[model samples]
Target: MDGEPGRCGAGVQPRRLTSPGCGSGLDSLERRVRLPSRACGFLPMNYLPFRLLNDRDTFWGLLWSRRLSGSDLLRLMVFIMVACGVYGAIMAGWRSPRLSLYVAIKLPLLFLATTAFVSVFNWMLGLVFRTGLDFRTTIWMVFSAMTLASWILISLAPVSLLFMLSGVPALGTEAELQYAHNGILVTHILVLALSGVSALWVLREGLVRLAAPGCPVGLVLLTWIGMFAFVGCQMGWILRPFVGSPFYPVAFMRPDCLERNFYEFVFGEVMPYLLQGGR
Candidate 1:
């Protein structure tokens, strides 16, 4: 009774500053109940890029975490894109030592155009479909999806670098290097496809996180995905020659973007097949 408040005799102790769980205050209680600081630090900001780059759960958590604002996600997304663009552009440049600068220019256009097109696409889709997501949030989701795609590409930088350094001799005849060059092009296309799929997967997960449980993907999402693929392919074709040319001795933008337009190429590749199949 000397300093204790309302002490119960013998078995029970007074609720005092030193008593366990007895009026210790919220701060102290929080410390006892809280997760370790390191574990909590993994949630949104600190090392999130690394986690999203590697951890599937962390990437999924990113979209759902209340702690992450749309703007916060966008900022991180842009940072990832910048890293992707730089990594890809530099590797392209480094691969084609003579025309490195030329190889570098197209990728930035590809990156910027892809991002811009996706944003506009989201806005237009939102207006038409009247989905739950607003224009800004729709845009942010697209940004996040592409960020995942970009992270995938970033992971492939080393593979691209390896390809850049290895292959048939640069001095060899075109016929001699044709298959090897085709292999390189095929590899790039595969990487691009995988990255696109990665983006789609991210989009699906994020939407699921936003949507009601057990619901199917709506028509709005389906349509958006179709347009996203078409836009991505056209953009890729427009900014061609990401991999340096092994055929042409040296020329910045060798065939050049305007000269290598996609429509004519696609029509040439697919129209004849369709016509023959029809016949």
Candidate 2:
């Protein structure tokens, strides 16, 4: 009876009861349990502790990170050239000989100005996008988009003005002056609307980067003020020639023409210089 039922100890089962395979079913159940898979994969499988980057090192790193494609640079250059040509044609076309030469002389200045504006706008956008502090490529894109928009608006301004004037009341002296003034006002409003839209578009792209602390409010405000002042000064200069001249030809000059010039001064000179100085 001892050999058959309790070989090792009194009232104890055989050693086979406590062997490795005794809990095989329980081990299989435990092995089958697993964590659920993530759909988006936003969270890391393993996360390390956060560490702050060095200020100078981080800045340099960011500066080096921003890069542009050949096509982007080419587009930027073409846009600048086209914008300058359009502005020059608008400004000097009526004056005859001054047309070609003025455009030629002003081309360089226009190029410089447009380039600067694009650069700053791009930098602002980059900061907003939080693209790790790199700004070179961002600026290139901004400049390209703004320049292209400006070219399109300038090209369309004359056609739009002509359309507006076709409906004016042709009667009294007051009516004539009012009509002229309204034409100018409307053209200016259109140009500004286009420029504003372009700026907002550039800003939208940079907003992500700008979400961090220490936004460039001061720089942006200063840029705007500088642009306004430059426009005022240039307009004053242009108008000074005819300020008191009774012989000033209103017949040859459209009110919309003056207003458009004012905007050109703002976008073509003031904004660019402000950004250049800021840099």
Candidate 3:
């Protein structure tokens, strides 16, 4: 009786079906696919940096899909600056407060400047390699990976400081001070290398996602990484004094910073010494 087609009280004709499936299907899709959001398609800014570290898949998905807003990028950069500053201060703490302050400023500059300098080359390489990313996306990808490296450094700053304090005496004879300087320098090199490796691991999946149909992602990554490192090493050379030395004054930059780059130093000084077999 109630199932009759013309029954007067028959469920109000299902509310006239304003949208196909009554909008429920679309709502379910959004909930299943998107990152945690306060509003539809909008991630909360305060929680984004944590997501960048912990939810790489979702974060990269949003970035690659062009769904991320300017505010999201701004927040990411702010976190990078602060994280770099923290590690920089720790790196220079062995020298003096003044040197610490100087490095705190320089380290963030180093990362940003390196990214800015290599952006054009990076975008060109992406195009030549058919990576399916534009200039803006290419730069963002490189910078974000660099930021993760900085995050790793920040995470290890305390442990680094502990070792530096215990193993490298702040006040000592000339031989002792030289040993301390070299020790701290080598320690930083190792720590930085580790951070770089970790960042690369995290970015591997993202690289696959951004590559074009037939793109050789490994080759593209190699070229891009080589270029970035080539530029970054020279940038670090120019912005020297990161591992501060008591022998040198606490200046913002070395007086001869522009005289020669890292390559020249390696070829002229380091290579010669190695070739001579320490005499």
Strongest candidate by lDDT:
3
By lDDT: ranked, best first: 3, 1, 2
Model 3, residue 14: C-alpha shift (Å): 44
lDDT of each: 0.58, 0.41, 0.74
> Candidate 2 on 207-238: residue-level lDDT in tens?
32222335454454345335534543454344
Global CA lDDT computed for model 2 = 0.41
Stretches > 4 Å off in candidate 3: 1-33, 37-46
Predicted candidate 1 versus true structure: per-residue lDDT over 1-279, tens digit per residue: 222211212342222122122455434534422222343333432455544544433333334333446666756656665656655564554346545455455554565577677777666775665444556556666777777777777788788767756753455677766766676668777887898788887676556545433334466578778877677678877655676666555655435666755778779867887989955
Q: Give the per-residue lDDT digits (tens) of candidate 3, residues 1-279.
A: 112212222232211111213367446434323754332234342266665665555455456556677787777678778988888888888888888898899898898898889889888988988777787777667767877888798999988889768888889899999998999889888988988887676555567755565778789888878987999999999999898887988899999999988999999899999999966
lDDT for residue 52 in candidate 1, whole number 0-100: 50
Clashes within 3 Å, all models in order? 0, 7, 0
**Predicted structure with the largest TM-score when compared to the true one:** 3
Give candidate 2 misplaced runs (Cα > 4 Å): 1-67, 87-131, 154-158, 161-182, 209-279
